[model samples]
Target: MNAITKDVEMEQQREDRRVEMAQAKDKEDARERERRWQESHQPRDNLAPRWREVAGRDNWVGMLDPFDPLLRAELIRYGEFAQACYDAFDFDPYSRYCGGCKYSRRSFFQSLDMANAGYEVTRYLYATSNVKLPNFSRRSKRNNAWSDSANWIGYIAVSDDATTVLLGRRDIVVCWRGTVTQLEFIADIVNFNQPIYAEGIPTPDRSVKVAAGFVNLYTDKDTNCRFSKYSARDQLLAEVRRQVLRYAEERGEEVSISITGHSLGGALATLSAYDLAEEREVPVTVYSFAGPRLGNEPFKERFEEILGLKSLRVVNVHDAVPKVPGLIINENVPEFVRRAGAAMPWSYCHVGVKLALDHKRSPFLKDTAEASCFHNLEAYLHLLDG
Candidate 1:
């Protein structure tokens, strides 16, 4: 009731009000900073006109040296598309859906929390199992297994109308799943060459040979698996043809095919690109990550000079997979030496422009990480971002 006590209480109330206002102002400043950061990082829009350059039609030209922000964003985006295949795949042998996609085509993106991916899954691709089950995939040995004959290899997805408008083309994506470890991938390399024409591939040159292991992976067929009596190659060509007919020819839309993969899947992507684009009018570009040498010198020349494919292969210098299948006799040697070794079973050559990145340069990763860490698709994506 005293005047002095009332005055003290009033001053304390005013001090409390000032403290609260200061805290609120600090919180508002933090939120404003976050908004600005996010706005700066969003990918640039209206890529429709420059999509050809982004797709490497000009061999990526000036865009690659300084590493264009749009190009970097697009590369990471497609790399994530390849990573999506691994995320949506059913890997556990105990589950009945093992060696298959975990979700249907309609709900594939949604199931992976990628509802805003802006691509529609049109078809699911399957391939007869080739590599051993011990290291990579494990098919159920129980009587109630899903399919012992085949595995869900990858998928075919097309950009939606809204995305197409922004991309300047109806982009058809062929993404393949790759093995996690390099040791598992190494087990499947046969190091032998087979003429692609022998397999009824659409190519005029009979001498265009590729690794027998890859050719078998593409051409092999099994009937017991669902929606896959046709070989992976057959399924791919058929589906791409259908998409091109509907979009490019019928609908009068600009279209392009982008094939992506990692490790074994990358090798298959290269093979599929050649088969899909050779002697055809489709504009196909490959975004391969951590892929090995795909084929012989003739095979490379046939696809690039003759068929015209723009391939951008992203690789880590520390990764060992890119150096094999042609260590002794590869494109690095002299012309006469390469010609002399071209007929050998072990001779191999890579296709298209290589975008080499280094793992040591990444500050987040440890310098002593295992070999698998270096070859991981996610790791490749991180490097691409830098």
Candidate 2:
């Protein structure tokens, strides 16, 4: 072979080795998860009476420190729902439905072999990708196939009769898909806050604002794509309103909304939870992992104090994501110090309880320099399992 051909062959060999190693890692992860699942056995219990508290009504008081078994189990359960979005997404760019869900909504859980999830997919959520943001799954969209204007972001699932009885209340879940292999979304964040009114979230407080990039994704519309004709925010709100009417208002059932996501999805969860709580009387709670701070001081105040949003953020202390956007001016700064930039758009704050975990303490996870592994959803579940 010529010198150029020889170099190409060597590069192919290295790439093959990397793929092989990644496959091995996947197998090891699966085995580890199976082992952990076998060890942690939480028996099924009728949680109907305490469902609100389980969903964080009292802000998870007395349930986080010792990592209450029921609460931990519920968190894991919700995490799996978020994980389902990633699993069901059609990541193959060559597939005709590249940006849409791989399975029909009716068969979503069944196709994923998650028949035990006990929730039915009510609506598939879609969003028009911002021109500035990187499209992680499909770099180059093919025309006349999947609409370039849209991508399936996640889905909303409601607990069935069996699940509702087991969990103690009718639960409405919104699971926004985050990333595992693709981390381009993180590098693309604009690191600025915009007024919440831009997204049509009716807050009288002028100071309340959110990350410009996240709000754009939640509120942007694409009339060309059938899936995203309405913004993700509108789709979510309409369906939630419908579900509440059919199950709660009409049926006389106790209903609760639990929003869960990891990484970017977590920011959306927090944003949507605030929007929903602002519109209705039902209890709303957020379970997010490795999510970045999404809003400013006034936004946090309105989200938690006024809306009574119950958020449980489970993050690796080592992950860079949770400590960003407002790295210098966030809530951690002394109150007087934060007030220095309270008038600025960059002064952000996290709103809710934090469940911090250290990956270094884990014996299984590799001690890596990159934050993606630490920011991984499976990694969060593994750490939470311990």
lDDT of 2 by residue, 1-386 (tens): 69999999999999999999999999999998775553332214746667778777788889988888778777787887888888888877778788678899999988987766788899999887573665443432555666767888999989888878877778899999875543566556546788889778888887788888889888989887787899999999999999999999999998889899988889889999999988899988999988888998888888888878899999899887888778789989888877668668778888899989999999877788876787888888887776
Backbone clashes in each candidate structure, one number apiece? Answer: 1, 1
Error of 2 at 181 (Å): 5.3
Off by over 4 Å in 1: 1-43, 130-134
What lDDT does each candidate get? 0.82, 0.82
Residue-level lDDT tens digits of model 1 in 260-360: 99888888899999988874687899999999887888888887888888899898999988877788888788878878888788888888988889989
Cα lDDT of candidate 2 equals 0.82
Q: Best candidate, lDDT-wise?
A: 2
> Could you tell me which 10 consecutive residues in candidate 1 have the lowest summed lDDT?
35-44
TM-score of each: 0.88, 0.87
Query: Candidate 2, which segments miss by more than 4 Å at Cα?
Result: 1-43, 135-141, 181-183
lDDT of model 2 at position 135: 45
Q: Give the clashing pairs for model 2.
A: 48-168
- Residue 341 local lDDT, model 1: 81
